[model samples]
Target: MDMMVSSLQQQRAITDQLRREAGIKRIPVSQAVEDIIKYITEHEQEDCLLVGFSSQKVNPFREKSSCAVL
Candidate 1:
């Protein structure tokens, strides 16, 4: 029993040391969700529509937008 407890403690210490060395830390779940939402909103128009839309839909919009002027 004593040996088991010592082994568990040693394992925990090693895990903690590894996490610290790797800069692995926990964030609140809400913060993670917020970051994901912000990233999706920022990237959605450029990544999703640009690839998924038909050229017919895309070319007209592009012609009306800054890309046309460029």
Candidate 2:
């Protein structure tokens, strides 16, 4: 579990660095999180994906899985 958390953090850092290098407009983390919650609240019955990181070795999703890492 700790290793998976580390991997996800690394992925976030790399992507954030890339986005900064590209000079893209960045949203505040709080606002982004709010948007996600709002979306999920409204679309509760639909399938939604909010993948912060994709790991080849440790995918946390499974069929009918109720786990949400956030």
Candidate 3:
């Protein structure tokens, strides 16, 4: 459990670093919604309703911090 937590933290740090280096700004709610729409359209056979729900529930606040990655 300890190792897992530590690994997760490291991954989060790497992700944050990449995000910063690539100049990828935080994803806006509108953009996320649009991306979900595109994804659903491209994968028509998939369950889009569930994907939409999950996408909407993605909390930007939770993603802003770097604690760790698994």
Candidate 4:
């Protein structure tokens, strides 16, 4: 268990370093969810369009690999 925790910590450190080097901004999940909910509520009475992004080709027949809201 200690080894696993250490490994996880090391991986997290590496990830954080890479993100910093790449100039990537991380968004808190709660804030993202709130933004989505607010947008939906504000546009509930009218048509709202959403665009999806994926790194790989998507097939309609297969279930999405990630959460639809993500």
Taking all chains together, each candidate's TM-score versus the true structure is 0.39, 0.36, 0.33, 0.36
Query: Candidate 1, 66: how far from true, in Å?
Result: 38
Q: What is the lDDT of residue 70 in candidate 3?
A: 80
Writing each residue's lDDT as its tens digit, candidate 1 over 10-33 gives 999999999898896779999999
The numbered model that scores best in lDDT is 1
Candidate 1: 10-residue stretch with minimal lDDT: 61-70
lDDT of 3 by residue, 1-70 (tens): 9999999999999999988989966789999999999997888756555444356456343445566688
TM-score of model 1 relative to the true fold? 0.39
Candidates 3 and 4, the one with greater TM-score:
4
Pairwise lDDT winner, candidates 1 and 2: 1
Compute the lDDT of residue 52 as modeled in candidate 2: 41
In the predicted model 3, the residue pairs found to clash are 7-69, 8-68, 8-69, 8-70, 9-68, 9-69, 12-69
lDDT by residue (1-70, candidate 4, tens digit) is 9999999999999999988888977799999999999998888665423443342355344566675664
- Candidate 2 TM-score to native: 0.36
Off by over 4 Å in 3: 24-70
- Our model 1 lands, by Cα RMSD against the true structure, at 12.3
Candidate 1 vs candidate 3, lDDT winner: 1
Highest TM-score: give the candidate number.
Answer: 1
- Report the lDDT tens digits of candidate 2 across residue range 4-39: 999999999999999888997779999999999999
lDDT of 1: 0.80
